[model samples]
Target chain A: MKNLLTSRWFGLFIPLIAIGFGFFAGALIMLISGNNPVTGYVALVEGVFGDLYYFGETLQQMIPLIFSGIAVAFAFRTGLLNIGVEGQLIVGWFAAVIVGISIEAPLMIHLPLAILGGAIAGALWGFVPGLLKARLQVHEVIVTIMMNYIAMHVANALIRAYFQESGQRTAFIHDSASLASEFLAEITNFSRLHWGFFLAVLACVLMWFLLWKTKLGFELRSVGHNRQASAYAGMNVNTNIIMSMSISGGFAGVGGAMLGLGTFEYAEILSSFTDYGFDGIAVALLGASNAIGIFFSSFLFGGLQQGANNMQGQANVAPELADIIIALIIFFVASSYLIRWIYSRLQSKKEGK
Target chain B: MADILQILYTIVPAALIASTPLLLTALGGLFSERSGVVNIGLEGLMVMGAFSGIVGTLFFESIGFGFASPWMGMLAAIILGAVFSLFHAVASITLKADQIVSGVALNFLALGLSVFIVREVFDRGQTDAISARLFRIDVPFLSEIPVIGPMFFSRIYATTFLAFIVVAIVWYVIFKTPFGLRLRSVGEHPMAADTMGIKVTRMRYIGVMLSGALGGLGGAIFAITTAGNFSAGTIVGQGFMALAALIFGKWHPVGAMGAAVFFGFAQALSISAQQIPGLAEIPQVYMLILPYVLTILALAGFVGKAEPPKALNQTD
Candidate 1:
């Protein structure tokens, strides 16, 4: 037990400790602002866990984080930086929405079609940077960033032209038939939880399977560790780069569809994006890019999001404080090396004891 | 003749303002990139700066106060940006974390922090527009010249001039001075520079901080000139465009300036496309997406063989 506690698992322990610190810090800030920290935290805890409705909302938020987290994690495993997941998500969302509304189909067909549409759109979006990195030798970072603008403008234009009705968002998907219903929602009231949550979990499982089980996964991981050696081993380095981005994008796209078809249901013209794609980056990092880790981390993040409003409403604190806390959490988590060093030193002394 | 001149006349002024933010940030990125660290946190720095600039101007509306206030805002933004960038520096430099992941984390942290602060302070998502916006200043004697005079010399913001001066100063600092040479050397080969007694980590920190300062300046100018208010879109993708410009410019100050001006012209063309007789039929979105699409193409083709600093991906 001592050995296990002192091992690299301590890396995971630090973030949990950081969360405790973040909460304490947040409470102090609340106190300074003349709000009761305990009340705020109690409200937060109650809002997220008190009722089924809030629980569903938390799950709804987790859907996007799961897929986007996988997207970032996939890229991380491949030794590439896919900052353009925002752009990819936008494009994929548009594609899925366009198909969701444009085609008329039975429930079984329509749902699969919309999800597929999103996946294809996202994959294509990812392919651009992947191809650029592979063929042209341009950095994925630059390509992804540039692609983000193109995706944004393109998505915005499409919304204005086709998806919107007289400048408002398009009509709701075909009422009950077009929506994704979850057993959990039925068990409770009409909560935000839907079938998309399962899909998100399924995606996490599939991601893990692909990363660890298959030959493609092995090749991809090997290439990520060292491209030159992977090439010497006869792995197609360029192909893997493009494939990784495409798969990453597809995951993010599916996440986007969950928002449009499952949760939000109606695609409104946003001046900016929903930011789930960006948040996914933090989720992926915090989860340590593991399937089970992503699941738990995403839930934690979703809880924070769900509880933020509670803190706002009950404690008279701004809802945005949740975002600040999330940011701080990610900041501390990203610098885990410092925390780990401290952990190791303390562990070494204990081992001596 | 009159119609063509009209097109030219319209594009020049539009391009000048459009180029200002890109010019400043690209110069900022140049420092970081040439020193061998890719500063993807440019976007976050720009956003923070934009928020503070508008806040400063909104709280103090007089001309002198606005001028001084924006600088104070710039100061606040720089501190925030520098602190935020330390996240990247620590991850990428000290901890040997992937620079790209670190950059993405910075992007999120900045976005979340900015939105949180804005919502908390303003009770709404965005700041109120500055009452007294950045004013146009015409050159004393040069404003009188026909066509070119007003287009080039007149009707430009003071920030535009500052961008130009910054470019020149950056160029001088990077190439002419010993400090710049050392910085450049560190970016290309940290191990070699380290062997030569240059503190590689410190230099990287300086590069990141310098980029943060300039990015903040760019973001401030963007808010003051274009939006006259701080909103989520204030800095937007301009930071990425600045990143593109850094690569397109081959990591040189003058090259970045030219690339920024080119980008400015593309951006201005899209806006003025509606005014052009033949182009009026094209959708406004087409014009809006013009700069971005053109940047991808330029990166693919026009930016040929422009190599990044050798040690760009090197950590230890």
Candidate 2:
């Protein structure tokens, strides 16, 4: 019974059940608010999958989420919680936009350079907290939270000073630096579905391979699992910590580049957090901090966010319901031990019968 | 020199008003962290309190309890805050979930739920301004004191006095009481506390609830004083600032209060920077980012390593 409950497939079942409960709680909230749950859900489903345009929108939403989720999952595997993904992502977005606008090169060189600029900026952002934690044992949670605000302000100030074009946002990037694809746009009925979607998928695959197939991945995971033990086993814990955070930040940086070079092709002044970073934390948690799991969960979150507009317009359900449901889902996932206990108890009962 | 004093007079009152909320919320954080459960959801809890406080005030006023509305609003905030915090308590203590994740989830839930309710009930993105706000009060004899009176007592919100009184009570409860010992022990060494018949889970639960109540009061005070209405941006990052103050104070009630005042002074400076002589040259964005940068420096142990509760973030 224990073995069966501990099986790999059973791990997926816990999140599935949590998702179900989350939906149930959301439906109850709707009912209490005097809205019809069935109509609301139908609108939600149709919003994400009704037509090619809707499906494309959902895919567009999924791109950044997938990158951020992978970023967070990667850091978690190294036993570090990268709450600073938001800061890294914002810095990355600014770096990509700056590079995209400044340099005028051929498409082949310019696109990659812009993306790499973002990745490097994000890596630097992640490196600060990583260095602090490694040397001083300073907690990353508060530091990252602080860095997020600083990053937002810094990004805003830089855009206002250098990149502003008489609007709240910067000038559009050069066409050669953009990730938008004409063919993909035509196929999706002119939705903003771009080449970044393909990049997101590639990132997931890369994360899986890097974590499971490489010696450094093993060292990173070992350090995450047991820092003292890893140190005794001759691993340079500080270097690995910095490397893990840098790599994780790189993923988020690319995710941020998707926003700059794909969806918007410009950077806007942000008065508050973009919320993608926070959403990434939820996605990583729901995905159990695994690459493939992150991909699927990102799609789920993307669908809900995409559908929320329709739900609010047609069913008279507030768009905030999606946020509430997502929060509940994370809450349930955090309580997975209870789910495991219930699953094991039911398994034992079935065997006894 | 006279101009400087005039600026200080305006800034000091603003600082007192600002610090009141932080002082209340940081005290709440101290309680939860002392019991070994890191409640990063203080921001969310504060949001809930602010929303509900306004709602309660409006509801009571509509029913013709105009004079009693604000106090009633505070009471409702405390009840709702305690209820909302149960999710954190269950997730962290009973289910043994990751405390940070649970706290973050609570923040999301609070923001989403409050916004949803506001749209439904008020048909707007934010709640209507409450008619009966907690007004500034003048102390009888204290207000007559020459320099000290105007800066400290006159034209201050009752919540500011309430905050100081709460701090003294919190200090007494946390230091001089038997319950405080058990709560501290549970945080430091839960296994040892458990073996000593102290009931670590129960102590932790009580600590979290106390935090919720105080956090709720802080939110109520913020709503009544600064915001005047509940909007999505009303609690913008203050809860986080309070968390920073909690760390800056090194997790003590009096220390937390002192840190809260320091943060409040920073906030006050940012608001009135143009009036100040030297700070007028810097961009507002730089001033806005100052508190957050200071928070990071504080956490980096520039003031000294702020030791957290030993069993903090550890699952049972």
Candidate 3:
């Protein structure tokens, strides 16, 4: 009984239970709203898997979520919460668009350069708060929150000044700079699914390798686990903090680049936040802050997002109902102690039997 | 000189109006933080408060409580705000969840639940504008004063005055009362407080509830005075700005009020920038970004060391 309780699998079990509870609560909410929970859930499932186009849309949604999830999970492993992923993502999208327009080259050079530019911009944005926290002991949460607004306004101004194509959005990037793959599109019935999906998968693998195999990753995790002990053991805490944040920001930057280059092929001015960064927090928590876990969690969240429109249309459930369910999932996951307590009681009952 | 006075006339009253919500919310944050429980969900709480306030007012007006509907709305907001905040308190205090994550979760829940209810009830994303907005009134004796009267007393919201009064009350409660001492002790050193027979959990709960009450009132004021209706964007980033004010003010009620006023001045300037000579040349986006930049700089210890409550995010 004790072994089962202490096993590594228990960590995975708690989140599953939390998700189960979340869905149950969602069902209750639906019932109270005078809707059939079964019908709504079925409609949601069909929306994600009804046709090739729906599947493509789901995959497309998963791409940025995967990137953002990895970004958040990496930061968590390094003992940081990168709430400014939204800011980094916005800056990255802008940088990718800037590079896409300014540099006239073949796809071989232009696309990679645009993507790299985005990563670099996001890295720079992440570096500022990381540097401040490491050097001056300033709290990262408030700084990151402030940075999100600053990034939004700056991005808006930049789009208005340099990239305005008539309305709030910029002109589409040249073909060479685009990540839109015709082959993938044709297979998916012309959905927005693009090469960025491959990039997202690659990022997850890279995250795993970097965190588990690399010496720097070891140092970063040590610093995150015990800053005082790590510092005493000769790890450069400041450097690792900056490195973790920069890399985390780079991941979100890639997500933003995927949005601009693959999905929309242009940067649009936003009056409010895109919310992917905030959603990344929930994903990282549910995924348990691991590469494989984040990938799966992102897929789930992505499916929920894609399925929400269908649920609203077919079942008369508000799209925001999905958000409420996601929030409840997070709430349940946050209260892991409750899950642990419940598991212990069940285990004791089985032992007595 | 005349132009400067003219700008002041336009900016000062606007600044006071803007500062009211920030001051109220910051005071709410002050209470929660003082009890060692950080409430980043102030934003979410404000949203709930604003939504409930408008909805309550609309309902009361429909039922024929014409002149008293706004007060009833504020009352509803306070009750709902406190109830909603209990989720954060339970998650953070009882469940021993990471306070920041729980707070963030509360934010998502508040926004989602409020929007969902709005759609379910109104069949739209927003409610109709409430007709029972809180009106501004001039103070009897104070309005007769010279230039200062118009600037500070004339045509100001009663809620603004209420916010200032609450600031004083909070200051007195936090610094001068035995209950305040116990609350501070639990926040700073829960184990020590426990050893001394102070109920740490109870103190923290009260502190969190106090924040909820003030936050709800702040949201109601924002809805009644500024938004006049409940919408997703009504609360906007005012709750966050109030948080900044909490930090900038060094966690003291009077200090937070001062900080809120400073931010309010910045916000007011942003709104009226195009009307001001020479300020018209600069882009409005820069003005919008200024307060956030200032907040970041303040937090970075450029202005001064903004020390937070000890053991603020620690789990018992």
Scoring each candidate complex against the real one, what DockQ results?
0.52, 0.82, 0.82
Candidate 3 error regions (>4 Å): A349-353
* Steric clashes per prediction: 1, 0, 0
**Candidate 1, pairs of clashing residues:** B35-B187
TM-score of 3: 0.98
Chain A TM per prediction: 0.93, 0.97, 0.98
Tens digits of per-residue lDDT, candidate 3, A244-297, equal 999999999988999989999999999888889889998899999988888889
Whole-model alpha-carbon lDDT for candidate 3: 0.89
TM-score of chain B only, all predictions? 0.92, 0.97, 0.97
Ranking by TM-score: 3, 2, 1
Task: Give lDDT tens digits, candidate 1, residues B16-103.
Answer: 8898889888888888778788777788878877776677666665446745676566666666666666777877788776666667
Residue B149, candidate 2: alpha-carbon lDDT: 86
Q: What interface root-mean-square deviation (Å) does model 2 yield?
A: 0.9
